[model samples]
Target: MPKCYWLGWSGQFEYLERAKQRLALVVPLTLALIFLLLYLNFRRLTETLIVMLSLPFAMVGGIWLMWFMGFNLSVAVAVGFIALAGVAAETGVIMLIYLDHALEEARTAARESGRSLTRADLHSAIMVGAVERVRPKMMTVVAITAGLMPILWADGTGSEVMQRIAVPMIGGMVSSTLLTLIVIPAVYGSVKGWRMGRGPLREGAPERMAA
Candidate 1:
């Protein structure tokens, strides 16, 4: 019985290896192109850098969870990570857009109130932006997780394969969603600080503009 089980496991591993090799070429090239596009489109070094930095945390968390689950690094897991990159990017884009809108609104409000923009205003803007955006963001994550729940919990008929892919994706999505809301803001703030501290770049800008 053990011999038969070993043979079956070995066969499964061999099949996974072949699938991985085929996927490897496509995945790396696709990721490279996506990143290149992001870099080109954003233009600003600080903004681009923040996006790049925040994007990988999700994969890190997903892979960490996979390891904890004692799963081998299979092609399914690789695919999950690839899918996560897109998801993380989407979340980042949404957060950044909302942040920008919040800042603009705050600046407008400050100007109308005869108050100069200051660091406090910037912080308040971000807080307000986060609060306003939280509902949609949470809903997005919940909806995605809910949609994928069946595959994650599915039994029989390709369940093993589904589990492998779904587990990492779910983990990555959840972790990335939280990090996008929290860590990305912090990173944006830090970058804003460094830029402001350099002086001229921040010249004429409201002192309150945090990020």
Candidate 2:
């Protein structure tokens, strides 16, 4: 009969257990903070929801890239995702700000002219806002990806941990940038268009829409 009962420090699985517990606590807090920030920034539940949706959209590439790299989820990866969320939210905010400014400009013009905001007005505003902001979006994405490049390609020492942290941010930035540049505007335009169309229709609305 033999019995093994020797313990030094914690145990073989202690590190993993600690990591899991840390992740469990941190993930929800991070998400809650993100949600609160989004709600505060947008001040409209629908707009906040739209921005929140972009977080998952941004994560798509991160998941795929991680899988392709054969990396499993870890604390570093979770941290990366948290960072990605903040950046994604920032990009979303920028896009929203541009769109809001454009819409406000159009709204003011329409109000001054004694006309209601129309789908056409919204469409034009969305186009101007989204397309005109491409330079800023590109710069942001480029700067982020460029900054992560060193971490992603680092070697030796703590490279493994650094890579895990950098991978999600790099991939996320790519997707989030696209979402900010394209999808968000499309979604905003669609929502605003539908809402505007539902309201009082202006004269020549159909003709203007067709043309």
Candidate 3:
């Protein structure tokens, strides 16, 4: 046989290598931008951290589903995760919005009555805010799942890539919704309650919380 010659990468592998390099850079940048936006929105490190917690909750399902489906880490899967992060953050924002409103309303009522904010008041506010949001959040998850289901089941050309993208979103949305509805309220209440217990509620306290 003639002497073999070496050549540089070509085809999909070349594209994959490029994607891996870009992904390494992009993921950290994306996370930093997200943190900045969260901080800007809440104006307090505590509340920003609370909202950031949703990312882990979202990741749990995405990773689990990818493993279950026997999918490897590809550019498509990474894209799915990025998309999932966005939706998770959005749901977290919504939760924070409702919680802030309820808490502020309770604070106003307590101030009018000339009494300190009570644990009972916090419980009531959490319940009202969390319960009222269930329908909308479920609807969002359901709609997303429905749209992705087709792509997941398809076996035609490009189905593999599409399915990888859809799987993470579908799985992440379910877990994210549950956590957003349940965990977020509990955490927000705990944080706010801690703040309340530390001292008398200052007039500016509400402004510090995520609204």
Candidate 4:
């Protein structure tokens, strides 16, 4: 008898194996490019990091949905995840922009009043940015969800693959929107307040030196 060897996986498994290879290569490159664009947009590591924080939370929902739906890892799913990352990052950027605008306003107010920036000012800025202007962020998630919901229920031609693409996006939008509204604001406030707190110390250092 001759010994037999299994040369490669066949059918779906073969496709899956190849997809895994491509996904591993493509996902990281996609993320690196996203972060590069983010860094370029904000031009500050702190802000860029705050934006980057949303990506993981965004993935949380996609992974959960995929597991719940019994969907195995495949090319369509990977594409959905890639799309999710971009949208998640976009939402984060929008939230950050609002917060930055509010903070800039606060800074202008403080300068006009001849007072130093304070934690209270930062807190108020966050509230104004995240809470008051929340509709736009919510609308974004709603719009995406509404658009994809039909695909989930779609039948006949191409629906299966389309649903795979839509599922991650719908789930990710929910989680990412929540993060953009609630978590990002809190984190942004804390980071900005800490920087503001150190400002006084640095300013006072010159006085101490003069004394």
Best-fitting candidate, scored by lDDT: 3
Report lDDT (Cα) of residue 135, candidate 3.
89
lDDT of 1 at 109: 83
Predicted candidate 3 versus true structure: per-residue lDDT over 1-211, tens digit per residue: 4479666779999899999999999998988888898888877788789878779888899899999999999999999999899889878887887887787888799989998888898889889989988988989999999999999889989999999999999989878987999899989988877877897554544443344
Candidate 2: the clashing residue pairs are none
Tens digits of per-residue lDDT for model 1 on 1-211? 6565643456877897788788879787977776776666554566666766776787877877778767787777777777778878767766776776777777688779997667777787777766776888888889878877788667888887777787787778878877888888777666655654665223232212223
After superposing candidate 1 on the true structure, give the runs of residues whose Cα lies further than 4 Å from its correct spot: 1-14, 110-116, 200-211
Cα lDDT listed for each candidate = 0.72, 0.81, 0.86, 0.81
Give the count of colliding residue pairs in each prediction.
5, 0, 0, 0
Error of 2 at 62 (Å): 1.0
**Clashing pairs in model 3, backbone N/Cα/C closer than 3 A:** none
Instruction: Please identify model 2 stretches exceeding 4 Å from their true place.
Output: 1-12, 198-211
Model 4 pairs in collision:
none
Reference-based TM-score, model 3: 0.89
Q: Work out the TM-score per prediction.
A: 0.79, 0.86, 0.89, 0.89
Cα RMSD of all models vs. native, in order, equals: 6.1, 6.7, 2.9, 7.1
Deviation from native of the Cα of residue 51 in model 4, angstroms: 1.1
